[model samples]
Target: MKMNNYYLELFEGRKNIIILPHILPDGDTIGSSIALFYALKKLEKRVYIILNDKLPSNLKFLNANSKIITTEDFEKLSIKPDLIITVDSSDTDRLGDRAYLLDLCSEVLNIDHHSTNTNYGKYNLVNSKAAACGEIIYELLKKLKIYIDKNIATALYVALSTDTGSFKYSNTTPLTLRIAADLIEKGIDFSFINTELYQNKPINKIKLLSDVLNSLELHFDGKLAVIYVTNDMLKKNKIDISDTDGIIEYARDIEGVNIAVLLKEFSDNTIKVSLRSKYDFDVSIIAKKFGGGGHKKAAGCTIYDTIDNAKNILLNTFRENFR
Candidate 1:
């Protein structure tokens, strides 16, 4: 559906705008936010991209102009936004503590591609058919007649590439690649972005990966593959939670593995679960069961329980749900 003209008018009328992304911002969230930031700035709009967490070290390259508002910066701000545009978040709760700030804004616009999006916005432009939220944002910018500069192109490319696993995942479509090709024509150093985000792994990340792989276990006749990362493991390796980013892919790629799970303990006995399916299986269903959501092949949720408890629950769910 076309974005409502009321939202377009709001965008053209609003003076102070804020672009919000989900907490623990990933590549897609950060990239889409930054791309919009540039697009709005081109129109001389007062805009800020506020995120609840710091950018991951790998994705910091996408911040072409060093413009990103962290929770620390946002807390001290005196300016109330006229408009709030949330990108890449499936639901308002995904905004984390920043969700409350919506009350201060006159309008809320949610732009996402998640199938589970709740449309929690005064005006929402959600396209579940899009491979990533970046695709939706790209279309929005085109409708607004914003020029896609090198920086914007690079950011959108990062957004599209990361969410689609550098165009290797099942979610990638012909249109996805075509948009990427157009972005490349804008003179983005695609090779550098790819290498920096994917190939250049830190030593701490390697240590974390080793420990995680060592903890790997295959269950239910090798169909359910699981790996656990404890706070102690992260502390011992001197690595942050971001280091565990893509380690679940290793477990899921194992031969004969149907569903792969990565369980990591955060603080206060809270465990985060990442799920991946190798075939036609729907991991998002399991994620939604745990009060979280994502695409069919990859999804995640957080469980406020012990590691063992979370694992047992997931195992039970898999046994009962898997066909």
Candidate 2:
């Protein structure tokens, strides 16, 4: 939908709207989508939020918890949506099995904060400066005269928390914190949400994290840290992809390590690459070279080949870019 006004553009003569987030949905993805969902519902627009991954339990308290459409449901829906808005999706392919939803809509609006975004939709408001897409959604809500309620505030708060790394990441701006202050004043329980969102990991997740961290390997004068989680690793630990979450963060926390890469083996010889940088490196450029995109500090891609090949490509590129 070609919309001069942000909110009005999303509504562009549409009754049924489908909102999609990227696969492996994070706090920003879910939070941004939920905030928009709240505003869209208040306008009485028929919006169905579709997500391909499991809803991170911390966000269940949001207003649209019951309204989320899963990947399974997206496949079964025969009716095409009048408009489709995708939040935090780096590209059309990032929609995974639900990429078909992009085709089902008459118009597509892309909302995201990734520096490496492909701008895949018909309409896009991509901002790399914003800490989280939820913040952009918050700005969008304000423009539409949407009320700042506890549910919406709580959802946006989670988005800020995660994207800013709890305000520790460089992405956190003074404006970001000011917006956060406004969200907090809306009677959203920060203490409860904080614990639930950050502290409430499953036991299996913790176990898998422990196993993965113990197997961490360092290279390149200890500037790089790599954690490889194979199919055997997942099966032996009795943990799936969900359990592999946060393993990269453990590697990033290592002293003197400027870069962290998590290698998760997928079906066939494919591997997923997650790159997180602590210095002034643009991870997105590396990711974009690999046909992936994200922020400067964190970026990722799914390599259709071996872990070694992927790592070599990254190393060669890093050497060319930074050495």
Best by lDDT: 1
Model 2 Cα lDDT, one tens digit per residue, 18-112: 88888777788888888878878888888788875666555555544587877677668766788889899888878888887676765888888
Which TM-score value belongs to model 2?
A: 0.92
Candidates' RMSD to native: 1.5, 2.4
Model 1: clashing residue pairs? none
Alpha-carbon shift of residue 123 in model 2 (angstroms)? 1.1
Q: Per-residue lDDT for 1-323 in model 1, tens only?
A: 57666556767767888888887677888889889999999888998887656567788677533677765687788888888999998887788888887888758989999898888898888888888889988988887888999999999999999899889999999999999999999999999999989998888888888889999889988998999999989899898886677889999999999899999897767898999998999999999998899889988888999999999999989988655
lDDT value for model 2: 0.80
Clashes of each: 0, 0
Task: List candidate 1 segments past 4 Å from native.
Answer: 4-6
- On the 0 to 100 scale, the lDDT of residue 52 in model 1 is 52
